[model samples]
Target: LRIIKTVPCLSRADLADSFVLQASKEKKCPDTDYLSENGICCDQCPKGYKLIEQCHAPGQRSNCTPCPTDQYMENRNFYPNCRSCKRCKRNEIPVTPCQPTQNTICQCVKDYYKFDIDGDTYECRKCKQCGVDEKEKQSCTPESNTVCECKEKYYRFKNKCEPCERQGSSFFKSTMGNSLPVCLTLFLWESKVSIFYTVIRRHATGQWSKQTVNYCTHFYLSLSAPHSHLSIPPAALSDLLYTVLDLVPIQKVKQLVRSLGVTDTEIAQAEMDNRYCREAHYQMLRVWAERKSLAGVGGQGELFDCSLMQELLDKLRKMDLGLAVQELETKYGTL
Candidate 1:
């Protein structure tokens, strides 16, 4: 092979021209270069040695011994010697093809990605399961990850899928998202658009409160005569009263009672007289009174008026209706 020599004071173009002059006419020289000291060469570093520095002259040393495992050179060179390779980062595997002349390339395990996806190179992504309904149905891939979701029978809590606990309720993907609600909680029956709320019972304390429902719709609310009548004795009124106090805020009760002409003093007396009512009643009164700046001392002193009674009855009807469905399903399997 013909060689071109690089000399001092000669531009690369001039050297090429001179080498072409000395070449055979039939050689048809495509390209040539002068080997320079401390300069990178076209060939890779030989085994057991690495190019740490390059030669600028034709006869200067253009090769260096391999760097020790502890040191490595940062760039290609034919110099004194290569630096030691850097230690791999935690949980990172270095590419074996890299050498002292090139910086180390580290990659994380398959389970980890750089900042999940579309993240910075220094970050790592982790694997996670899908939502409850999709626990056995969904998965993740390297390029894209699965979104947490609620399965057909499961609901979501804090982005985690949880099984629907309320009987007669199941996870359903509504326009809003996957949620657990009573199957027919909002349905049209007999030309009446009925909506329902839930009351979660405290097994140990027997206390009840309205379990929030995501979807709220208008209902043709009505209360049965028996549930609306406070004259039936407090024992018979416990469940009905519990249901009422749970669903309607005290401010709403006050408004309904005021509409019936019941004085705040009477409201206060009824609260004090009822032994079975929970402390939640006072909590409601305090919040409502503080909010409305109503100085009147109605602590359930007087019974709620007939309309308030009607609200209680309507709430109970929904609860009882739900309970009936749950009972039937339990006896005969899901219906």
Candidate 2:
């Protein structure tokens, strides 16, 4: 009988060590070269060129061609084709033009910033402009938007800046107890109405002083002079009508105008007179307002009144258009 030799089986640890040794012993291509399909180390194509054919022998250069226009090859590589260059989108300006060896770099134009990303590119949006009573705290940049703050003597209200109102010296004395009476006059114009407040206060020492306080137009009308007839000017009335139109859909606006006594022919004529839908809607509302004024107690030339606004509000409520009604109430305050 022939004698048989037994071989030892490798443990898990021994197999792992064997794999590590094998990996360490394997040859790796240098940074300037890449391993070919034939297991040969071939020289790489330089930047701006793409590989057309592999090297025939080790240490030999590969066949390469320059990248076509609007294409790029950014690094020494073994790729068969060059990459396509990037293009700038709307509201964007090219920072660095695309070249054979590099991709295009883009940035937002002046008064715009990067708002979002679209795949591998950026989408730009217009910057915000501060209101008249506000000042810019930070200027807008390509990467960031504008920052605004209320100016001196103004306070922020509902995202807008409004001038601060002055109270009489007596009112301040009641609150602060050590103030002297001062005279001032404040005039404000709103809806073609010029309003000014004059207050006279008698001091404890028998001195007479006059004081004036400027209050917000809407606030004063709503609270202090509730019974006063504050007629809405024609321009202000037009703005409110447009606001109503904007709160509802176009179909709803047509329904509203019709309900307010605008004829189909009138709507068609308004459409012909205006190029835009919003302008046409405004025209229809204007006609409705004119008709209502003509039928009111005040004569044909009377353009605006509190009754007209209340009537419009009543019609909107009857239509169950709560959003439009709410917007008008919020803007005009109990009109």
Candidate 3:
């Protein structure tokens, strides 16, 4: 508690030297040596060097050597040998390579994979694709590979699970309208150059009986040449008529003339097809008809009218095929 001469600011180097001298006087290990695990002062090996020999006495230095080019010792230790450097696997890639004082770290290659949720990792498995009748459910990750599942239309076909074709041969539509291929032809139709209705061996790609012709509602003009298929392209009507009619939309239709631009040969061919379709539809209705009439069964009557004449010239004076088809089909029912 008595006030005496005090020195407050001491240089760092002199302060450290005084502290080391006092610590040594107290029997601590000197700067040249460190306390080993066995409680003896020994010369320690530096990182990247391993001890080749140990000292039995406190003042003797341990024999040390640098780790070999292909080996390492990452920390100071009394061990007598360096560890062998890690080698990359065939499917593994080095992230950080081995150095004098560092260990090599590696990971699975891009095309390699493993599914370890938690625990030690095993060898990488190669990436695989979903096979036939299967679809990818989950994409691959660095840790986990892809997952697959059977497709919605998977069915046993020709001894293997295969994708079902849309309403083709062997496929049938269920009551709920789910179509599956059955590998058998349920129905078919054959025509000339233009294929009519063909449910071939694969998918359900075919034609229908009545070829739809969309007449413009405003200009009262034919939008496109009539043909039979499932999808009707609606924009062609809007695009074509808008160019001519002051951009006004199409209106109600006129009583039919020959479809615009359809050739005479096509018209004759169309007449034959229509005659066949009318009779086919008529026979179906006759089954439930209280007053059945097989009037136009064999193309014997007029095509343009109900006149009983094989001479087609009478209707040539004024023929409207679309109106005539409507009148013929409604002879029995309203459809």
Candidate 4:
């Protein structure tokens, strides 16, 4: 028995496991304390306070101090310094002021919604207001935006709410060779050129109307015609302006107006005159339109005209605002 008491050789893995088991058996700091650099279990700094120095020995409290002004320590932590509090941005208001143990909470101001950029940061965006032809389906809230729908007897056509035409009005009807009444709508194309075509057929009930027919086809044909010098109707032009405002981003409004020859002083004046961002943008566009009209056509008192619209579209194209141009063409018929 004393001859061969050979010891079992330990592998590197076995040594590592034995060390890990020994480490696991060591006493861990309690929830209220943290392991300090000197291998001591130190009491954690309480909420509203930060650690100034670690405890010198086991079962001892760390040196701590209250968070400074505009700073916070939200939890029991052993951090060396407190976190700085956040400030509310423009169009935002503080919902809850910062306290030593808590951070400030912020929310969007009235008529604005919170727009998150990264997950940790956000800004406020102006809430959308429904147009005259649309009705509010859902009210705006801080977390969500307004929802709009076309009003009664109005339908969405090319992203705008247009009134449904009455029967036997706004278009001429003539009999074709097949005895079907062909609806003839005169559409004014660019540069005052007229495009006349039969776009709709009379229903079996003998009642035909623009709304009841394939109005989209008529719209396509009208816009697809060759360019001419036709002036857009005043109402249509107004709608186009609104549509342009909707299509152009709020951030890019200043750049757009500047490119369209609006001076910095005028832009600043518009900002002073209008409190809301949307109103300021609309006012700037109005100023740009009036100035362009005056310079191009000797101030006919028309804020918008065919030539002005063409020039605007050209400017937008040059500025790489193709979405606005495409939307304008889709909604109001092409220039």
Q: Candidate 4 versus the native: TM-score?
A: 0.45
**lDDT (0 to 1) per candidate:** 0.41, 0.68, 0.43, 0.68
Q: Worst lDDT window (10 residues) for model 2?
A: 167-176
lDDT of 3 by residue, 1-335 (tens): 99899788889998887775665556556565666543457877888998877776667788899998989988887677899888876688888999878889877788666533222435666765767876776665445555454465443222233443432443333232454222222212111010112222333466333221111111111212342211113242223223212211112111111222224454455456556643322222222111111232333211111121111112311331223222222221111
Over 184-235, each residue of candidate 2 has an lDDT whose tens digit, in order, gives 3333223332233445678899998875444333222211234343444566
Runs in model 4 deviating more than 4 A are 1-25, 166-335
Clashes of each: 38, 0, 11, 7
Q: Point out the worst 10-residue segment of candidate 1 by lDDT.
A: 326-335
TM-scores of the models, in the order given: 0.28, 0.44, 0.32, 0.45
lDDT of 1 by residue, 70-144 (tens): 556664443455555555555556756466446566665566433321112244346455433554433444332
Q: Which one is best on TM-score?
A: 4
lDDT of 1 at 323: 31
Give the alpha carbon lDDT tens digit for every residue of 196-280 in model 4: 3345546789976443432222121223224322333455545656778887766677888898888899999989999998878
By TM-score, highest first, what's the ranking?
4, 2, 3, 1
Off by over 4 Å in 2: 1-25, 117-121, 166-335
Off by over 4 Å in 3: 1-39, 55-63, 115-121, 151-335
